[model samples]
Target: MLKINDITNASSAGAFVVKKGFGAILAVTCLLGAACSSQSVEEGGLQPVALKEAATSASTQNVADKPNVLVLMFDDMRFDTFSYRGGPVPTPNIDALAAQSTRFDMAMTTTGLCSPSRAAFFTGRWGHRTGLDDNVALWHSRQTGLKDEEGGIIKRASDAGYYVGYVGKWHLGPNGMAKRGAEFVDTYKKELEEHERQGAPYGRMAQTKRYLAGERDENGEKNQYYLTLKGDYDDTQAAQKVRAGQEMIKSAAKEDRPFFGVISFSQPHPPYRVPEPYASMFPVDEIDEPANYMAKRVNKPLSQEIPWWPWHEVSHMTDNDWRESRAHYYGAIAMLDRAVGEIIQTAKDEGMWDDLHIVFIGDQGSMIGEHGLYDKSAYAYDELMRIPLLVRDPDVEPRVVNRIVSLMDVPVTMAEWMDLKPDGAVDGDSLTPLMLKGDSAITDAEDDALYAYEWYNGAWFGLRAIRTQDYKYVWNPGDERDELYDLKNDPGEIVNQIDNPDYKAKLLSLRKRLELRLVEVEDSSVTRLQRLIELNS
Candidate 1:
């Protein structure tokens, strides 16, 4: 464990240093105290038995004795968008939850796009296995020859005598639509058409119900957004979905079986539109652009092909346009925070808070103009790959972990908590060890690297990236362009150090590590990229 004094000393000597001011020294001391306290709790104070021994004993307990599960997923939300993380946006409700939960500083999604990453969560399988590696509309389960598989954590809970219900954002497939309550498909289709005619983006329940009914826009648009403009926050599509989740929780409480419900919200995504009160939550002048918001896509792979949009080119937008857009995005996030608070409060009201294990995470992160990208999928930047993951387990230590953990580990961890049989073939390991140990066996250097790929567009492209504490390396096989950044020296990832011969050995070693990981994971598609590199060689 690195001490706070050690961190302060290193920071003072490093390029990014915190000055030895009274405030800075005080902050450092406080941080060190917290870290030391957490370490002590994990060492022995939290449990009488050894951490490993306790985990084994807990796992032996049956599902009926296990804690109830509530998994909430937010859409297009970035890792640092909450006020708790010093983000400009205010999310008091989420911040409150963080105070009581264990927050992960490094949680990544396997894929940065919506559908593919979402499928990964539901199936507890990689995007390749789920056949949802891309976000193309034509790639529905039926069209892809995919079958409804019971592989999500929900299935494990259901098998453990828990009533499972999923609410909001069923991007995995249409399987959840009928479960959402719909008698006639045509009725939903008609409702959507009516909403479209009225120029109202599909309100929450209306849009989800319509999508489940297999409704499409007259123009043959693929996503639900096409049928209805981005809905407003109050009466918007996302809020309605959240309301449905609240109702489901209330209903589940009435049932005899302990319940596991997923509340997924779609917001802070494209069609950036929010309704009243929330829409005006943030003033225009207060919206601050990202530090690297103006970065150009020069000599970069994948990103060079993407066009510059308002998110990246906010400077080009008129004052009014920029304010309205930023306001809406922030408001949407506020709406999500409120919904989460309601859910948490509901659990308390229903007497389930103490006995329940809740997890909150985003499918993948979105870039709100960071590195000049808007929605994810084009690049593997931290803003797109890194997501927020919060876990609240009464049996585990409550502390923040800076170690890297992937979304792939969520299902296995949930299975362990629920005392259900785990599908052993998962690429991700259960994070229960970290939850109990307050540190990971894998060092920061070992856990720094992550893999992201996109098979969309005209070609199959792969980006192998390794993000160390002080540097980042991006290997693009298709373009044969490698990017390296000394993150310690340039936190903005502005300058590429790949051409610098001084770091040749380090780059080669990291590249080899990335390749080894691909092989270990049996990432066939990524391996294909390696083959292409070999063929070119």
Candidate 2:
């Protein structure tokens, strides 16, 4: 096992230099791991990314520049977990929306963390560029909010003479959504605070503490991480936000201008709380273990550290506990689907459905016991990277787009569809062509790969990854070993093929691709950390 002899601060830049012994120990471990690996990995070369030209707007609306736009963002919802994707729980409302939309089967967030992904989505810039790469707790402590290097989508739409509104969770920062240029803003923080004031402090931690103290809800059940709402779902904070969004749509309908509203839900994130029927929706016994539930963390030192990692509560959980938690999570999604159905109906009833561009997406996905992990980490697995993205544009052909897309592409796409002016340089491509022409829109394979990163959880333990159709390469700058997964053979990402001689060429190609991508995005961390890692090595 590799050991950290000492970690010392290099300077005021917050960079820490690990003792040379740490890198030496890592080198010895890599050699041992290589000796034990015998499986052959695919040797795929990285080709130049060919981007398709933006096609004409697929606006069937008579007023192309003023079509109503409604964006629904979810928290911690995985693409594969929706009913349309054959997930464990049923999501009829979302499935129906997918049937009428262009579902991007391979949509990913630039960063797997919440605040960073939301920041990128709003600004159409990469997380690092926004300086909000970490979650709210860390960045909020530093008094950082969403950096508008480029204008956010709401501001862009509002500037385009559209009535915009923002409701529910805005994890980007404090204050209401006005900073993002929403005419109407409703925050979940105020609602949560009110619930706490009502002598019911609702949250995963608070409820778990109650459970640990042998406290039970009115239902006489000791729900550890979940709570059962006794009253109607409409009275709940999330459901009330749905109504607030509906009101926004109605108010927009009254205006002569086009409507642009964002209804973001905080459900299905944690605490796993839901109403009665949804709370007991999925039976725990019927919940099957994920195929990679017992996956080993051989060459991946980061995965090995996850079990004992700080702030992770799954270390003491058993299989049954995980299943129960998953069931609760599924139930939460089911409940959220109910609210989704309501908001969609509101838009339709307000006669904005025909001209509305509805976007149903998740901020980031959670790991539901995949690879023996719960919730997200710095790792770049599909569960954490992939999100549920389905866009319903009336003019766009309703079909399944298998091309890789990113959340950063969303606002850019919206801007184009709404005919909003460009604010600044955006780090994403418009998905207008994909929506208008589907797979045939891409004439080249240059945009076939997706670049993702995470650098917040641990100090300077950054991870940058390049994911193609058949493989994933993760560059853990300060870790004992980097990771390469043959996605074709091991879709679960169970085996780490980094040290395998068979994958040497492929690994080198991906490493170069990631380096070039970092340069393209002007990520200074890459240059700084890459130098540090090389010096230590």
Candidate 3:
């Protein structure tokens, strides 16, 4: 393993320079993370991005300039787990929404961490530009806040004469840049404080439930993530957050305003606490192990330091323990779906469904025991990168898009549909064409590829990965081993084919593509150089 000191001391590693010490490095990393978060043009070039490149926003709304834009977002909900995707967990609410909207099979988060992903989504830029790359808030000092940025979306929307409201979790750094330009705001911080006062960990539940659920399984009493008989269904964090957002929707409707709001749910992320029957929704014995479970992953380079690494948890778990936890994770999602259904049904029943545009997506995804991993890490697997995206415009028909897309593209799409273009450049392409002309209509942003960064930590163990249709290339700087997976043959990414002679040409080609992409995105990391060297070696 690479020494921690070496990681901190390597001044030439591109993204970091210790200068004073690790403390100074952390401070600098956080500063750069928030500062470099938004850019007006493409990286390594000064040419202004043409908003016209997007398919002409042939708005379906009677009033093109004013439509009710609602973003129903979930936390840590991966792509495959949706019941419609053939996963064990059933999500009827999500599937019903997918049926009415254009479902994107390949949508990704630019950075697979909570704060940075949300920052990128709101700002429509990369984490590096926002200086919000790391999840650790202490690393970033958002002195001016996000709305202060020239590329600020909320302010731009507000300027366009739309009523904007922000509800639920806002991870845009400690300064609460998420509050910018909102007509009304109710943040999750107050709930966090309340939970602390009530002696409850807001995001987690006691582990005893998992143990009890497993014991029930062993005793042939069925299985569950937990079965709290007295737990209230409406008392979940998601339930409360959704209620807050519903109130905003009701108020927006009352005022007859074309409102833009983000209804984000903090569920299926952790604490594995499912209220009422959802905890016991999925039976334990029926929960099967992942196909890659116990496979030959010993040869794969794993992060040894993170306490929540899958191996760390798997080391102490039996098959039933794993199943119990897995069942509840899905149960939490099911509960979240109930909250979503309530939010949607309200719009339809109030006779405002015709004016509403709903965008459903997840902030990020978890590993879910894939590759012997329990949660997200520096790995570039699909389990953490891919997220489900559903776009429902009142003017358009339902279709499924096979082309690759990014959360970065969402703001641009929204801007065009609203007939408002900002003065600054954005890194995403609008999906308006796909939405208006169906899945066959092609835009500038095709099914090419997308870039992903797992920098929950700074450059200490950060990894940059490029995902294409057939393969994935992961560049881990310095002494860390680079990984290349042949997605066509090993979709699970179980095999490390980087050193195989048969794939040398493939590795070189992907390295060249990744290098050009990194340049296009202006990735200054030392791994920028290491990829070319490793390819040659």
Stretches of candidate 3 off by over 4 Å are: 1-64, 138-151, 175-178, 190-230, 304-313, 437-446, 530-537
RMSD of each predicted structure: 15.9, 15.2, 13.3
Which lDDT values do the candidates have, in the order given? 0.53, 0.61, 0.56
Q: 367-472, model 1: which lDDT tens digit per residue? A: 6555645455556677777888887777666788888788877777776666666643566777777887866656765676465665542235566666666667
lDDT of 2 by residue, 1-537 (tens): 111111121110111000000000000000000000001000001011111111122233434346677777777777787789988778798798889888889887777766677777777887666676665433112323565444577777666666666655665554425654566655433211111111111244454455455565555543433456554464454565565667767776676556677766655664455666776788889988778885766667664464222224455456766777778777777777777778778777877776667777887777767877766667789988888788777766799988788777787887777787777668888888899889778764555445455555334456788887788888776687888999999999999998899887787777776767788778876785456445533
lDDT for model 3: 0.56
Collision count of model 2: 2
Considering lDDT, which of the candidate structures 2 and 3 is the better prediction for this target? 2
lDDT of the structure predicted as candidate 2: 0.61
Model 1 is weakest, by summed lDDT over 10 consecutive residues, at 24-33
Q: Indicate the TM-score of model 3.
A: 0.77
Strongest candidate by TM-score: 2
- Estimate, for each residue in 84-140, the C-alpha lDDT of model 3 and write its tens digit: 778777779878877878788888777666666777777777766666665533222
The better-scoring model by lDDT among 1 and 2 is: 2
Candidate 3 backbone overlaps, count = 17
Lowest summed lDDT window (length 10), candidate 2: 25-34
In angstroms, the error of model 3 at 465 is 1.0
